[model samples]
Target: MTDNRTDPDPVADERTTLAGFLDYHRETLALKCEGLTDEQLRLRAVPPSGMSLLGLVRHLTEVERGWFGRRVGGRDLPPLYFSEPDNPDGDFDDLDSTDVATVFATWRAACAESRDIVAASSLDATAQRRDGTDASVRWIMLHMLEEYARHNGHADFLRERIDGATGE
Candidate 1:
């Protein structure tokens, strides 16, 4: 596949560097899912594990909404795919009736919203999380980077298993 991802700028400032890397990881996830059919995207390639490319997209949508929208932006939004106590794994589990187009659209929207939130706020700005603890925008960005990096690793393996294709 053609990799359209731009490498993070080496001489950029702290904020720019973090955002660039986070975006790079985001693009990595998308690249992993590129050219796959709907059934392939939803295929649980790894045995005994319910993880799939579509599930990763759905889960990251919730994560972006939670960190950028709910926690950082101070929006009282509900979960996108899963509930708190019940069906927490719904993002990964409830894919039988999911519309692939809608899920991708929602994920892109969340990423855009997150970019807006980051652009409007300072890295030092803090917000209260669900546990009444405060997190700075810098911390949130780092956390998001970590989250995406971890999941993207999974995406790499999943994609390879699906089609024997692999890359950084």
Candidate 2:
């Protein structure tokens, strides 16, 4: 893969720095999926692990919706890709018949909504978590950055094993 990701400026303010890094990681995940066919995307290249690039995309869509839409925005939205108790790993495992274009579009929309939610609130703004504990926008942003960074590492390995393609 081409390392087209731009680095966040170290001198920027906290919000800018966090947003930049988060955006970069998001783009990196997309880049990793680029040029892949739906079948290749759904391939569990790493084996034993049920994770596929398509699965990662679906999983992140749910993450984005959970954190930004449901929690921060306080919207009563149902899970987009998976449900607990049954098909908990549906996001990662239910890929054989998934609509690739729809899934990708949903992921993009979720990211856009997440950006909007972040924009309308201050970093200090608080929202209630599932346990009724409050969380700041700052904390959410950092958590999302961490989430994507970790998943992108998995994406990196999967991409490498899939095509011998390498690098950021």
Candidate 3:
């Protein structure tokens, strides 16, 4: 894939740096999924793992929605994929019947909403977590950066395994 991801500015302020890196990683994931058919996107990694490019997209959609929409934006929204105590892995596991276009659209929407939330809030602004602990916007962005970095590694492996294509 042609990498169009913009590198995070090394000397930018904390919020700018975090948001930039987060956007870079987000673009990385999309790059990994580019030029693949729906079947290719759903192709599983090695056995015993349900991970796929499509699954990663779906999972991150939930992550963005959970952290930004619910926690930060304080929107009372329902999970887009999995439900607790029932289908916890629904995002990754339930892909057979998913519409790729819808999943991608939802993910993009979630990301847009996250960007808006971050733009409007102070870095030090706090949100309540599931455990009743407060999480600052800065902390959440950092956590999201970590999450995307980790998952993008998986995306690398998955894309390579599928088509022998590889890059940062």
Name the best candidate (by TM-score). Answer: 3
Which regions in candidate 1 have their CA more than 4 angstroms from the true location?
none
Native-to-model Cα distance after best TM-score fit, residue 44 in candidate 1, in Å: 0.8
* 49-77 per-residue lDDT for model 3 (tens digits): 99999999999999999999999999997
Considering only N, C-alpha and C atoms within 3 Å, which residue pairs clash in candidate 1?
none
All candidates' lDDT scores? 0.93, 0.91, 0.95
Better of 1 and 2 by TM-score: 1
* Pairwise lDDT winner, candidates 1 and 3: 3
Name the TM-score of candidate 1.
Answer: 0.97
Predicted candidate 1 versus true structure: per-residue lDDT over 87-167, tens digit per residue: 989999889889998999999999999999999999999988778899899999999999999999999999999999999
Residues 1-168 of candidate 2 have per-residue lDDT tens digits of 556778899899998998899999999999999988899899896548899999999999999999999989888879877788887988898799999999999999999999999989899999888898999999999999999999999998889888878877
Off by over 4 Å in 2: none
TM-score of 2: 0.94
Candidate 2 weakest ten by summed lDDT: 1-10
Best by lDDT: 3
